[model samples]
Target: MERARFDNLPLEWIRAFEAAARTGSFTAAAQETGVTQSAISQRIDKLEKQLGTHLFLRQARSIALTVEGETWLPHVQTAFESLRQSSEGLFGAARSRLTISASSSIIDLWILPRLARLTEDIGAQLSLRTMVLAAGAAQEDDTIRIRYGAGDWPVAYKVPLYNEMIAPVAAPELLASASDWKELPRIALSGPRPGWNEWSARHGTPTTPLPALRFDTFVSALAAARAGHGVLLASLPLCAGDLAGGKLLRVCEESLSCHQSYWLLASNEAVSRRQWNRLETILKDPVPREGA
Candidate 1:
């Protein structure tokens, strides 16, 4: 008997036939797929027509597999299992424990907010380590590192967290005070991130406000900004949550885009191909959308 070309066969029909065959009930197949029993019946009927063979022996109160169906069942089941394994291996996070290291500020401002979704996407529980400095996250093996740079790491895999954008941002209340944002005391931090001088130069602004308060890290600088002490030239990616949640407000509509970005870097042994693919999908769009 002629058979339908495999490529032409509808996967949904195959799924209906497989589920009905496995459970010995059309009702059960419908329950599994959230469709009506008649829908499953229609699919299998169409499937039989395409294959030119009956797959079930229908009875008054039940059904049994035909000889052809019994012969074809194991092959279909094997194909389903193979598809499952391929999907899980390529897109599902591994069940192994995962270790990740990044700066305290990235962990606090960026990673922490998206972490629940991150873990879910990778399909593993995470062991997080806060890197004390930029150099700290690099000096490790069997750990995935989040680093900010031009993506020059000599690692097996590296993907950017998001494009880094900087601009003046302040507490909503501070901006609402009707104070000149440029005249408000600025908050400064030590990092490779572009600051007031770069902002002034890039956007054709004349004045570069000096910081009245300074800190060595973004966590401190942002805290001061949130408290309404001053405006901060902030990393938009890092403070994305705050801006979305109304904890902070953009001082201007413009953003100073940067050439560098935070990166997820990992050595070969640090992740499976499946896990890495999952990580890329999750981290590339790390920030949650508004009202989400």
Candidate 2:
């Protein structure tokens, strides 16, 4: 059997077929596509002829997909979805919704606090979406992406938000009269940052393992520390509020420069210059420092 050439199939016919399959009626498909019922029937017929297979089993009151049509439906639907997303990316969507995607930890610890100010500054409504950064995940081109890295995203307008500084922090109650803070249970972060081992080496703390509870994100570890569970190695920017309120205190004078920093990234067409500038300004404004 000869395979159909790509150019031989028209997009209009495919649209008609999809609408008919989805709506289950040629009349309804014609209404959706703004064509006559006969026109829709003709297009589906032409599509079936091009594919050398019958797609629909026509009935008195409705239509159902043939075995071949059922097999082909998902592929056709996926292709249409891809095309729609691509169109939205290129021309922008009709809605004024601005989406910002970032890691769950970043959103909770950093962005959420400043989100109201951001919306006020830009005078536009914004939506926040959390994304987990994993290898081989598709990058979202249609929304602003806040990522933690060395600030080298190709073909993107990039701005460094802030470099992270990490320090050992604990609830004030946890540190009460505790002479050897190192011996206390440590809440450890298991993610990308330099964690307990590096902090210990920097602060000259003993390398011996202590009672430890591990969390996949710094946010969770910080929460555990805030609840007086254990000492946490936490980022200063994210926990600045807790430190200032005396909810958490630095265990030692030692701090480590996280080399990795959070960066704001967007395609050139993703956001207007004015919108991007306002968002950057809002994010970069300094928060009240600990004890100040």
Best by lDDT: 1
Candidate 1 Cα deviation (angstroms), residue 6: 30
Which lDDT tens digits does candidate 1 get at residues 113-214?
667777667767789988765344336768989988999988868989888888889998888887667767788888898978788888887565677788
Tens digits of per-residue lDDT, candidate 2, 39-139, equal 99999998888788999999898799999999999999999988865665566433356789987887887787787677666656688887875789887
Model 2 lDDT on a 0 to 1 scale: 0.81
Q: In order, how many clashes per candidate?
A: 0, 0
Which residue segments of model 1 deviate by more than 4 Å? 1-95, 134-138, 206-209, 289-292
TM-score of each: 0.64, 0.64
In model 1, residue pairs whose N, Cα or C atoms come closer than 3 Å (at least 3 residues apart or on different chains), thus clashing, are: none
lDDT score, candidate 1, position 150: 100
